[model samples]
Target chain A: MGRQLLSILLLAPLAAILVSLASRRARIAEYATVAAAIIDLAVSIPLLLRTLSGSLIFAHGYVLLDAFGVWVILCVSIVYALSSIYAVGYMRLLNEEERLPTFYALFSGFALTMLLACVMNNAGVFWIAIELTTLVSTFLVGFEREAESTEAAWKYIVVVSGGISLALLGTVLFYWGSSFVLGPSYAMTWAALRQSAPQVYPPLLLVSFLLVLVGYGTKAGLAPMHTWLPDAHSESPAPVSAMLSGALLNASMLGIARFLGVVTGTSVSRFAHAAVVGFGIFSFVLAILFIVRQTGIKRLMAYSSVEHIGVQALGLGFGGPLGMAGALYHMLNHSLNKSLMFYGAGNAMRAYRSKEIKSIRHVLKVFPVSGILWLLGAVGIAGAPPFALFLSEFTVLRAGIGGSYRWVVIVFVIFLIIVFIGFLSHFRAMYFDEAPEGEIVPLPFTAWRTLPMWLAFLPLLVLGLWWPHGLWNIFHQVFLSVMGGGQ
Target chain B: MFLAHINSLQASIFSSLAILSLLLTFVMLGSHWLKNYVYAFAAQSWLIAALSASVGYFSGYRELYAIAVLTALFRGLVLPWLLMRIVSRLNVKREIHSVLQSSSSLVIGACVVMFAFVIANHMSRQQQGAAHVVILALTIMLSMKFLGFLMLSVRDEAVSQILALLVLENGIFLGSQILVPGMPLLIEIVILFDLLIVVACFGMLVRFLVVHAGTTSSRELNRLVG
Candidate 1:
């Protein structure tokens, strides 16, 4: 049953890609896309339920399904579903219906590659899947066919492909490092590799993990390796931008987390922890610095992504039940809040006909619903109460202090405060400032367009105030998986 | 006894081919003509294919031979043809626009090769079975990978950047030859497929740049900044 559902989740998108491509009408392609997303969400919910009951491993270890993998699939499908709906209004507003086939095709392909990256059992296949995500999204990034968009796509493809190739080298080295212990029977399968990791040579494993960290870390928008993040995130269409931030980064992080999971019992884990923690803190600092200076609203959201990704990496690196669980939980919260923010930014872009935060003013007066949602999203992502992000960030902070990383915790808090202030100041100018002189702006709002934002934001509110038992149980299992305890 | 003799014969051929390919990479790095760059890359791919075939002969792994054929078909012939078409489509004059003079670039390349040799020596001391030469191949690829990086940063043409990325991938492939000769065929296929897609995308990007911006130099791509 699990295998059947897995096949559906993986293959449905491919089928949609084909059907969308063959269709001539934009409406047909859009409907196909939304249907595929619905199928994805429908299939994954049951899969998550089953995974919570017990882990599912199939194809002789090619695909492993635990609560964590299911949780990621659920997040990805939810975002993709919302994005598909939002893309309807976004494309029609721009009158880009002629390009719908290509957009929908690549969108489906992008979602498929991300899903594959989450569940693939082999490290080599996982790396390939992540690389494929870049390939698909590059075209989507360049969908505007404008000079800046094309340039952004070019930079994104070149930088990310280069990074993933390094990760590929690391995967090869990992296979070599473990061949001594595993006797070359299983190749690079994660389950087999993890079983043999304890006996693998520490030097070789350390080298592989470092390479993997830098390699996948680039995809995850880790600082110092994230030069492409802002450009790609801001240039792509809003739906693509949302998926890149919300789903794709998490997929790459999942790859890194799994590698760390494999190395948990080994001596090299300390090395991995230090690297993750260092990169996380560095990214957080850089994000705060960049956030304060950004004028483009999408670019601001992109920097915030870097900062939140840093938080997750730091949580994972903190390496305890509280930290790891909080990291996983934060992944969920960050995906929801960040995607919602991008949708808001999209609304602002449509209304102002520009992405510059300084261009448009009186957002609250012009489009009250989107304006409120946008402001609330900013407050929500800033780690305010009544949002899941606040709970997750607090949990992570507690874990860090409890784990005796006092200095790091202090810096973390300082950076968080700075970023929170950064968010408020940037949006304050956008929301309350007067409009540019004699400039008239048209309002582009509809119930259908704004519905997805409210749909996504409600969960953030619900998850923040209430932690249901089933959800907590699943989070506990995922934490155990991260700690290398559960299957 | 027969197998032993065949192994030595195979080893000599492999060594000679690897060395020749390494030498051709220098020609690639120093060439001022884009056509020469393409030819040098194609020749290097052919040599890698031959070397893989010999590795198969010596190790008795049939999959390596298939890898060799795929390399010849895709890297050696198809990719070069695709690149040549892109060159003509862009109407690129046969001139390389690099930041450094030829003499200095060549000198830097030589220094990098020596640096790679030293690292390879250190690594080979801990491994086995002519793996030192393999590591030598690996380091040469690494240095050339740096050369690719140099080309990317120093050259003005978008096509040069594309060729430089191909150089980086070739370096990675060469390193894999020595690092894990027993890598799965499935992985090799996927890597090749990825290369094909990247090339296609690179060609499309170059064409787009030329059509829209009237130049293929990435230096003009500065509209997006902090």
Candidate 2:
């Protein structure tokens, strides 16, 4: 049953790609992508449910459907479905009817790679999958063919490819280190690495872990290495941006979390946790600084991604059931909330005919219902209460406060306030500020545009008020599988 | 295991090939012309392929023979051919906007090699009976990485940047061939094909850069700033 669900989950995107390519009409391609995405989301939920019983391995251990992997798959599928729906309205606005089929094809291909990255059981194969995501998404980032989009695509591929090559080197080092213990011909599976971790030289293990962290950190949009993220995210069409932030980053973080799992209980574990916390704190500080001074609306959202990913890093670094649970929860909430924010930004960018926050005024006047949804999403993403991000952030904070990294908890709280203030200030200007002079024309409302926002916003609100029991059970399993009972 | 038990002749053969590949990276770093960079990359790939074959012969990994052929075909022949096509399409021949002088970059590249050697020495210090070949492989692998990144940072042309990235991959491929020859053939083969796709994508993007962005140099591609 688990294997069948996994097959369907993987094949749906492939089917989408085929349908998109084969169809002559743009609407057919768009509808096909949406259908594929919904099927993937539907399949992934049950896949996660089935894996809750225990981790599932298939293809002679090349694919893993553990709770952790399935959770990321769930996040990717959610974003895929939402973005595909959003793209239907968004791409129509671009008026590139002839190019839409190709766009949908690449979009589905991009989704396929992210999903593939999640289930890769071999570390080497996982790196390849991540690399494939970069390759596929570069075109999507440059889909608009504008100067900025093309430039952003260039930088995205170069920086990410360089960074991920470091990950490749680290994986080689890991395999080499394990070879000393497991012989020269063993598979470089996560389980094999974990089994050999204690016996490998501590210094080698530490160096390998740090290299992998920095490498995958670049992909996950953790700061300093997150230079490519803002350019790529802000420049891509809004639906593609949603997928990049909401899906790709989670897949990369899955790699880091799994690597961290490999080194758990080793002598280098303490230092490893500290390094993660260091990057996390640094990213938080950097993101907050950028968030406050931001001008572009999507760029503001991009920095918030950097900030939330930092928070997730902190959760994983804190190393407990609570920390793991919070981080996983944050992944889902951030996906929903960030997608909502991007969809709103997309709507405003289209209606106002500008990408600048200063240019977009009186959002409520323009998009009465979706505008309110967007405003609440901005608040939620800013780590405000009665929204899901707040619950996850608070949970991560709870995990940190009693740990050795208690000082991080203090720093995390101070910045959460700063992020809330900095992020919402832009929204405040957009929502409540009076419109400049002439009347701005609003685009006609379409369910294709606002439906995803409503779908995303409701979940963000409910998850914040009440954490589900089943989710807690899933998180517990993830915590055990990833933390290896060390905490 | 391969490195630890290698005889002196095998050790010398591996070290020479590794050092020669590192030299080609320096050639890439010191050159002003984009074509020079591509040729240097091609040479380096061939050397690494040779090293892969030698390692296979010495270590008895029969699958690496196929890997060596693919590396030579794809990395050595096909990638450089694709890169040359990208270069010929562009009007700019040399890095018209040099971020650093070739001589200065060469000096910095030397420093990077020394730093890499120190790190490699420290890393391999724990292995009992570890050969100097092990240290040499680690150092050349790491040094090529640093030099590749240096090339990436200092070069502005799109083709140069692409070559720098290929150099980075080559460094990792070289390291893996020596350090973990028994890594599954499937992964090695997939990674080779993946690099092909990457270059093809880069070729298309370079054309996009020229037609849409008006320049292949990153200096002019900075329209999307914070």
Question: What is candidate 2's TM-score for chain A?
Answer: 0.99
Which lDDT tens digits does candidate 1 get at residues B92-135? 75545567887787888888788767655553323345554556
Fraction of reference contacts reproduced per prediction?
Answer: 0.39, 0.85
Alpha-carbon shift of residue A150 in model 2 (angstroms): 0.4
Give stretches of model 2 more than 4 Å off: B126-130
TM-score of model 1 (CA atoms) = 0.95
A1-487 in candidate 1: lDDT tens per residue? 8889999998888888998889757898888888899899899999998888788778766778888878889889988888888887787777787888888999999999899888887898888888889988998988888888888888898778777767876787678667666653345877677888888767668867887898999999999989899999999999999999999989998988888888887888777887898899999999889999999999999999999999999988887777777888899899889989999898888878888989868888777787788798899999888999999999889878876578899999998899889888988898887668765565556665788899889999998998666776787788776567521
Best by TM-score: 2
Candidate 1 chain A has its poorest 10 consecutive residues by lDDT at A178-187
Candidate DockQ values, in order, are: 0.43, 0.86
lDDT of 2 by residue, B183-211 (tens): 99999999999999999999999999988
Give residue B144's error in model 1 in angstroms.
Answer: 3.8
User: Model 2 misses residue A322 by how many Å?
Assistant: 0.6
lDDT of 2 by residue, A1-487 (tens): 9989988998999998998889867999999999999999999988988988888888988998898998999999999999999999999999899999999999999999999989999999999999999999999999999999999999999999999989988999999999999999987889999999999988889989999999999999999999999999999999999999999999999999999999989999999999998998899889999999999989988998999999999999998999999999999999999999999999999999989999999898889999999999998998889999999999999999988887778888888888888888888898888778888888988999999999999999999999989898999888888778885
